[model samples]
Target: MAKALMIQGTSSGAGKSLLVTALCRIAKNLGFKVAPFKAQNMSLQSFITKNGGEIGLAQALQAMSAGLEPEIHMNPILLKADGNKGSQVIIHGKVYKTLKPKEYYAEKKKLWNKVLESLEYLKKHYELLIVEGAGSPAEINLRDSDIVNMAVAEYLKAPVILVGDIDKGGVFASLYGTIKLVGKSEKLIKGFIINKFRGDVEILKPGIREIEKLCQKPCLGVLPYFEELSLSSEDSLGLSYHKTFSSEKNKLIKIVVLRLKYISNFSDFDPLKYEPDVELLYSLRKEELLSADVVIIPGSKRTVEDLLWLKSLKIDKILKYLAEKGVEIIGLCGGFQMLGKILKDPEKVESDLKEIKGLGLLDIETTFYPKKITTQAEGYCNLKENLKIWGYEIHMGESEGDLNLFTIKRFATKEIKKEGSQKESIWGTYLHGIFENDDFRRFILNKVREKKGLTPLEKSYSYKKLREITFNTLAKLVETHLNMEKIWSLIKL
Candidate 1:
């Protein structure tokens, strides 16, 4: 069996995921085969594996950091919130069922078994497994049925490193309290990692010493905040921290993404943040929507419900006005469905409503089906002929329209099919991560720049290359700041 080490956080956004990602890369750099595992992940940001399995985006990125292909075993259970329909529970990367909080907790025993199976599978394949815990392990109300956090650590006999965000304040209290709350599992917590610290480590030394003394565990390290850290967030809680660029003299393009109540995969636009001339912000206000040079309706887990939300806020009217003004508007996945003339859900796959009116930005219609399309796709832009692009599809609706945006094929399949629709300045596609493609994204952005009477950028940075660089940077940061000697000792490396 492979050695395992777990990273549990003091709170939801206490930087557990990034620490695991860094450790995975650190292990890989030292010539050890490493992998990331999460017993359960409740996040809207997901990635489709090569075999058409859906897993959390954080695990996928961590697998990349470890120089391994993403697999379902990395994240055995994924819960996606579906508005009034409760949460969509995925077991082993396939949709299991949708259940409310009470209903989900009722099946704790069964879910725990599945987590064990996945953990065993990863143990046999990799030399080291860096496990990430969800929320806080200190939830006393949830400890009885917990499948993640301390439960998984105890199951694998893995040493746990609890992390607390110093930037959130109460770091010492949070760490001390978490250890006290875990009860018998406190023995498994070998150390504490203080993350997102700003200013002098010398100033924090006294507090760190006190926390160590109180918890009877060493303070592994104090990681400084990295404003330039460009990894995809695990969930929506990190959305507010996204940089809002001012439409200043240097920033030419103002891209506004609608912050829907049920937004999923908002990280689809993360690539745009690297562009020097572009400014990105997520907002739902009518004034903000109307002021954008480019407006994007991102994917949502609950499409029909979010569309109704848009209507209630009168954001639907704003979108139409923007469309009439020739402002560039784009929709992705569920957002693509909302841009159509009508949406029909006869079997009620997504919602109770049989039919709902869309924004009518495109001359298209969508019908929800029981089966979801989850596949990696490659294609070329029809507008810029032969400009190749590739991305994954994760949607339950099929759109019918006369206008087509790209010619594509599913991975390992040769059947050519038309995907997406474009009419004038409005574009809609089911492809997630479309903006990650440098050539195609630049083509679309340059077109908008030309219309605004600004010079188009001749060259743009490669997002794929940037991701590799980011992984290395994170690994270097952890290695430099943290006591790797203690970390390796815990894993028996």
Candidate 2:
């Protein structure tokens, strides 16, 4: 059996994911075989494993840090919100059911067994397992059906560390209240982490000592805010990080994404943010769109509902004006469907509306189907000399169009398909992570640069290499601030 420790938070967005990732890398550096496990994850930002199975992005990054292949056992259950009262539930990397809050709770017992089975399987292989808890362990209304936080900690007899965000204010109360609300489960918590501390550590010492005295647990350490760290987040809560960027460089290309209400896969543009000649922004204001050299419409969890939102806000007219001004426009997944002439939902898979008019930029029509296509793909993009590209597809609707921009081979299959559509300055595709390829990303940017009469960048950026450097940077940062000796002692029997 593997020794285990869990990082639970006072609330969501308390830096639990980042802390787990750093520990995984630090443990791997000490010559221990490590793995990351989360009993359940609720996020639209997901990754496809080598076997074409889906898992959370944070777990995938942790797996990379541990020098191990990402697998289905790492994240046994995933819940994708459908922009309604329900969520699409995935068990063991496959779609099990879609249920509302009441219906999901009705099946809690059966799902608990499934979670235990996955933990037992992962324990047989790794020497140490770093577990992450979702939301909060003290959610009073959800404690009875909880299978992710204290439930998993009790099952493994793991030591717990409660983390609270000081940036959100009232850290002392939040930490003390969380410990109090967990009742008998409070004994498992060995210490507490105060994350995102900004000012001098001396000012916080008095409060920290008081908290430790009240809760009967030590304050492990206070982690400073890293303003320069750029990594893929697990969900849209990280969207606040993508505000304004005022670059003084000459001829900087500004790319703005139309931040949808139910945006999914926003991490698709993380690569673009790192480019030397690019400045990425997400906006819902009309003034922001007028300054953009290129406008991107990212994937949405509910295409029909979001499309209606665009119509309601009159952003549809703004898109047409931009397209006519010779600005480049790119639509991905649900956004691609919005570029078509019509969207038909005969089965009402997404909403109550049977059909809706599209942006009418491309001569394509999409129909919503019950079965979704989820697979990894590699292809040759239709640029000058055909740049090789690779990405994955996760969507419910397929399009019928006359123009094709890429020919791709689906994973674990011999079949080929002419996918994606392009017309003049507008391009639409169902592939996410299409810009991860260095040659392909640079080629697309060069096209825009040539049109704007700006000089093209001589060197291309490698996203894969940048990710490795980022993981190491984070590992070093945590090692400097955290109490590693105590952490190691707690995890050991």
Candidate 3:
């Protein structure tokens, strides 16, 4: 069996995911075949693996850091919140069922077995497994039903390192409380790490000493706050921190993305933030949509529900106005479904409503299906044939439209099909990560610049290269701050 070391957090957003990612890189750098594993992940941000299995985006990124391909075993269970309808549960990268809180808890035993199977599979293949826990292990109320935190650690006999966010204040208290609350599981916790520290570490030494005394666990390290970290967030809670761009005067092209309540795959637009002449904003305000040179409707897990939310906010009317005014409007996945004239969910896959009216910006009509399509796709733009694009598709149902925007082929399959629809300045596609393609993205942006009589930028940076640099930079940061000698000893490396 492979050696296991787990990272657990005091609270959500306590930086557990990134810490695992950093450690994965650090372990890989030391010549160990490393992999990341999470028993359960509740996140909207996900990626389709090479074998067409959907997994949490954090594990996928962590796999990349470890110089390995992301696989379904890395994240055996994924729960996507479907608003009031409940969460859509995915087991081993396939849709299992949608269940409410009570219904899901009833299946805890079965899910726990699946978690063990996945953990065993990883252990056989990897030399070291860097595990991450979901939420806090100290939720005494849910401790009996827990499959993700202390339970997993105790099962694997993995040494646990608790992480607390110093930026959130009361780090010492949170760390102490977490260790005390886990009861018998406290024996598995070997150390504690304080993350997101902004000030001097010396000032925290006294409190750290007290926490160590109280919990009987050594303080591993204090990681400084890194503002330039560009990793994709594991869940929707990080959305607020991602809204760094504003309608600055220096930026020539202003792009506004409708901040849908059920937004998924927000990372689709991360590349746009790197553009020199472009400013990106996520807002639901009417004025922001009206002032944008480009408007985007992003993917959502609950398509019909989010569409209704748009109508309630009167953002539907503003989208139509923007389309008529020749604004470069684009929709992706569920957003593409919402831009159509009508949506039919006859099987009640998404909601109880049989059918609902869409924004009516496009001439297409969409119907939800019981089965979801999850695959990596490659294609070329119909309008600009030289502009090739590749991305993953994760959505339910299909759309019927007369205008086809791109020709695409699913990876590992030879069949060619027409995808997306475009009419004048309005575009809609089921493709996520379309903006990450340099040639196609630049073509769209330059067209906007031409309309404004501004000079188009000729140079574009490679997002893939930037991701590699980011992984290395993060690994170096963690290695420098943390007591790696102790970490290596704990993991038996």
Candidate 4:
């Protein structure tokens, strides 16, 4: 059996995911077989493994860092939150069922056994496993039913490292409170890590010592803020912190992305952020759309619901005007369905929305069914240049239209399809991560640049290379600040 070390946060968004990823990279660098495990993950940002099983985006990144293929056992239980009061429950990389919060809590014991089984399976394959806990284990009211945090640590006898966000202004209090709330399980916590610190380490020494005294655990490390290191975020919180571009003087092209209430896979636009000539703005404000050279509707978790929201906000009309004015309009996945003439969810898979009128940007109709299409795809963009493009499709509904934008083939499979539509300046597609391809992304951007008589960029950023660099940088950064020797000793690595 493999040794396990768990990282639990004082609260949600306390940098648990990134820390685990860094650890995985370090372990890999040390020539140890490492894997990441999160018993239960709730996020809209997901990735499909080579085996066609779905896992959290962060876990996939961790797997890449560890030099291993992502597997279902890494994330046994995935809860994709719907816009409403329910979530789609995915178990062992497949959709098991949907459950409300109350119902899910009642069934935690059943899920707990499955989690243990998955952990055992992972232990058999890896030398070490770096587990991550969801949210805080200190939620006193929910501790009894907690399978993801302290319970997992206790069951596996994994030494725990409690992480707290110093940037949030209550690091010591939060760490101490979390330790106290865990009661008897506090013994499992070996140390504390203070993350996102900005000031000098000397200035924080007093407080760090106080926290250590309160929790009866040594302060493992104080990590400096590494904001420039860009990795795929685990959830919507990553989008919230990103500042929108308001200064158009420095940018040649301004792109506006509609910030949907239920947006998923927003990382698809990260490439645009690195473009020196492009100003990417993700905003809910309609006025921002007026200044855009290109307008984009990002993927949504609840397509029909978010579409209704657009209707309520009257943003749909503005999109139509932009498309007519020759401003490039692009929609992805759920957003593609929203741009169509109509959307029908007869099975109520997404919501109770059986039929609803769309924004009518494309002469297409989508019908939702229980079956979900989730797979990687590659093809050429159906344009004059026939540019190459590759991405994955993860959606519950399918659309039919005549103007095909991309001829797609599922990766590692013989399946092929003519996907999406392109009518004049308006375009729609079901693919996520389409912009990651440098050639395809530049091809689209250059068209807009040509319209404005701006020079096409001579260079294009490689998203794949950027991801590799970010992971390496993150691994080095954390290893420098963190007590890796102690961590290795604890995990017997």
For each candidate, the alpha-carbon lDDT, in order, equals: 0.89, 0.87, 0.89, 0.86
Model 2, 78-153: lDDT tens digits are 9999856599988877778899989999999988988998899999999999999999999999999999999999
Clashing pairs in 1: none
Worst 10 residues of 4 by lDDT: 238-247
Off by over 4 Å in 1: 240-251, 412-415
Clashes of 4: 0
Instruction: For each candidate, give its TM-score against the true structure.
Output: 0.96, 0.95, 0.96, 0.95
Cα displacement (Å) at residue 43, model 1: 0.3
Give model 1's TM-score versus the native structure.
0.96
- Across residues 1-493, which tens digit of lDDT does each residue of candidate 4 receive? 8889999999888999999988998888889889999999999989887666788888888898888888889999999987556899988888877899999999988899889999989989989999999999999999889989998998889999999999999888899899988989989999999999997799999887877777679988988987644576767765644344335664468888888899998888888887767777788777779878988999998888899898899898888888879999999999888889989888887777689999888989999999777788888887956678888888897898765888988874667889889888989898888988888888888999889987787656787788778888989999899888887788676
In the range 1-493, model 1's lDDT, one tens digit per residue, is 7999999999998989989988998889899889999999999999988888899999999999999999999999999988767899989878899999999999999999999999999999988999999999999999899999888999899999999998899988899899999999999999999999999899989888877777789988889999645687866765654454444645478888888888999889999987877888888877777778999999999899999998999888888888889999999999899999999999999889999999998999999998777888998989986799899989987899855898998873556799999999999999898999998889989999988988888657899899999998988999999999988898778
Residue 297, candidate 4: how far off, in angstroms? 0.6
The segments of candidate 3 whose C-alpha lies over 4 angstroms from its true place after superposition are: 238-251, 412-414
Which of candidates 1 and 2 is the stronger one according to TM-score? 1
Candidate 1 or 4, higher TM-score?
1
Query: Which number leads on lDDT?
Result: 1
What TM-score does candidate 4 get on C-alpha atoms?
0.95
Task: Report the error of model 1 at residue 111, Å.
Answer: 1.2
As for model 2, its CA RMSD to the true structure in angstroms is 1.8
Clashing pairs in model 2, backbone N/Cα/C closer than 3 A = none
